[model samples]
Target: MKGRFWPKARLGDVTCVMGTNGVGKTSLLRAISGTHPRSSGDVTFDGKPLGQMNAHKMAQMGVGYVPQGRDIFPLLTVRENLQTGFSCLPKSEHFIPDEIYQLFPVLKEMQTRRGGDLSGGQQQQLAIARALITKPKLLLLDEPTEGIQPNIIQHIGEVIRLLRDRGDMAIVLVEQYFDFAFDLADRIVVLRRGEVIENAAKQDIAREQLLSIVSV
Candidate 1:
């Protein structure tokens, strides 16, 4: 994840990371989430320096990561899968919130169903809901729209917007879908060969210019 950097993200804003495949977009997220080791540099959250912490430690510190591929427990029921997020919470906060169901109603209906039984989009929704269970201050989403249907993508986009409008958390979204990312981003960071070629406010860059940069 070297040579990749962006400005500090403020709460209530969406920062979209876009690039061609193999440009370390996912790796960048892994570094932030502490799912992968950070060889160098520092990551600070809420004005505190997070130096070489593990995934669990980061989660405890309010970093919620929904990685690519919707990695849900196949044998676990939808409710069970979400309950896994409780591991990062205190005993008093072990119960799932009604807002989780409110955000994704389909998960409420499939509460008892196994995660593997759900479609790709359903699994994606479950993955996101599970992350929200931690009530994270920083949410990292990697390719949420990948392999998802148009309708679900739109739903997810709306959810992201709602979450942003809530002004409670900061979101870092890694996406390859051009228009989808562009439409939701408050700021844009474009990467190439693990290097950041462009980083600017959404209003500062034209859509066509960004499309040309990533397309190259």
Candidate 2:
């Protein structure tokens, strides 16, 4: 994740960190997630600066990150993987809500299965479900459709649409798939080298323009 804008890194809104491979998309998300520290520029949420926030504090403040890899605990049962999200909440509030199942009923069906037993798409769903259990205001998704079947990709896209339509959360989608990103993104931020080369609303740009902007 090295590129042009290691010199300047700052983002907000429904920012899509898109570019050719190796343009620092993951690094940017990692920086925001506190998994990777910014060499410089501050990361903030809801207008409150992140100068004071660490990883645990960021989660408490509702920053959810679904990293590039679907890092579900393969040894744990599906239910146990979801429960890991509860560690962020108070003891009284530590339980999975029904809405999470509504978002992914496959999870409900496989609650007893070991995480390693699920398919790739199922694992992706579990990863996202794990993140949502924290009830974040800002969701960072990294190449969610990468390596999944088309049907599952559609489902994941629909889920993202539903979340964005709710309008309470700001989503940062880091993707290499132009078509998938186009369908769900409200705004497109194309990165080249590292700087934000083009930032435009979906209404303001076309597919070719977006593709060209991010093309190396």
Candidate 3:
């Protein structure tokens, strides 16, 4: 996770981390989300020093993570799966928001369906919806477009855009899909062998140049 870092992210911005496989993209997100321990360096959230807290603490501190695999509980109904996010909230705020259903209407259609029975795209949406239920100030999405069909990917992109434009949270998206990431990113950080090779505002870099850099 050691690299030349960017300035503190502002709410309403999307910071995309791009790299080839085995270059620690997922590892970076895991460390930031506290799912995996960082070997070195400090992590600060909301201008406060967060020194080696666990995942639950991170969640409570308004950090929501949707891991690479869209890890929804297989046996749980879709409604129950979303309810899992209730763990980090006060009991009074336990109800799922209507906006969650608006974001992914299929979830509402299949509320009683088992998570395992949903399509991959459906599950990805559920995973994101679950994280949104926590109402995070910082959302970390890792490889969200992987294995997703085009239409669903577009839908997810729109959802991310809406979330970003809402200006309530900062999104850190680790993506291998170049076009999708490039379109959404306000700033881009490129990594090679766990070190940052490029970090710049998206306007400062050309699409072709970014593709060439990551292709290597």
Candidate 4:
């Protein structure tokens, strides 16, 4: 799968890729996260080509991926779902961080609830929380706000802002919602047919400008 409409390019702090449906946003993430291997091009981390690594290797190297559609274990309890990230860590460091719960308190209250029992927003939160437990350096989120409610969206935005402000992590977001992506992204990447059309900082482009890129 290749980026449609939106070209592949780099942005500041964030290498965001945006476009309409079927633009391959999810596929770009899949390639970067190593879920689907890239046909070419180099995905480098700390100056190393990511193509040389595997999924587990990528995680260990600090890339946390929260894919599209909130892929949580429907039957698994919230706690168990979080525990899944433990595989990315060594035995000594294998424990869900307290910050994870602090970041998404709803998860604390619904600890015993099955992932599928939660609403779409709650499931999305759980899915993100599960990723945060891994303590990634480069967090890859694919349409995190998709199908989520407004309040939850705000919370997620704050969380993302906090993570970015920390300055230790690099975030790559794939989004269709202009306002949502614009607000959270330090920079934006516009996709238009497996190619990067525009990549610039938030301060560099206005809302209308972004809308024009996504409008097909």
Candidate 4 versus truth, CA RMSD in Å, comes to 2.8
lDDT of each: 0.95, 0.82, 0.94, 0.81
Top-lDDT candidate index = 1
Error of 2 at 41 (Å): 0.4
Q: Count the backbone clashes (under 3 Å) in each candidate.
A: 0, 3, 0, 18
lDDT of candidate model 1 versus the reference: 0.95
1-216 in candidate 3: lDDT tens per residue? 556775566799999999899998898889989999988878889888899999999999999999999999999999999999999999999999999999999999999999999999999999999999999999999999889899999999999999999999999999999999999999999999999888999999999999999999
TM-score of 4: 0.91
Better model by lDDT: candidate 2 vs candidate 4: 2
Model 1 misplaced regions, further than 4 Å: 1-5
Better of 3 and 4 by TM-score: 3
User: What lDDT, from 0 to 1, does candidate 2 have?
Assistant: 0.82
Q: Select the stronger candidate by TM-score from 1 and 4.
A: 1
Q: Which residue pairs in candidate 2 collide?
A: 4-193, 4-194, 5-194
Q: Tens digit of lDDT per residue, candidate 2, span 67-178?
A: 9988999999999999999887899878999999999999999999999999999999999999999998889899999899999999998888888778778889999888
**How close to the true structure is residue 191 of candidate 4, measured as C-alpha lDDT?**
70
Question: Candidate 3 at residue 155, lDDT?
Answer: 99
By lDDT, the better pick of 1 and 3 is: 1
Better of 3 and 4 by lDDT: 3
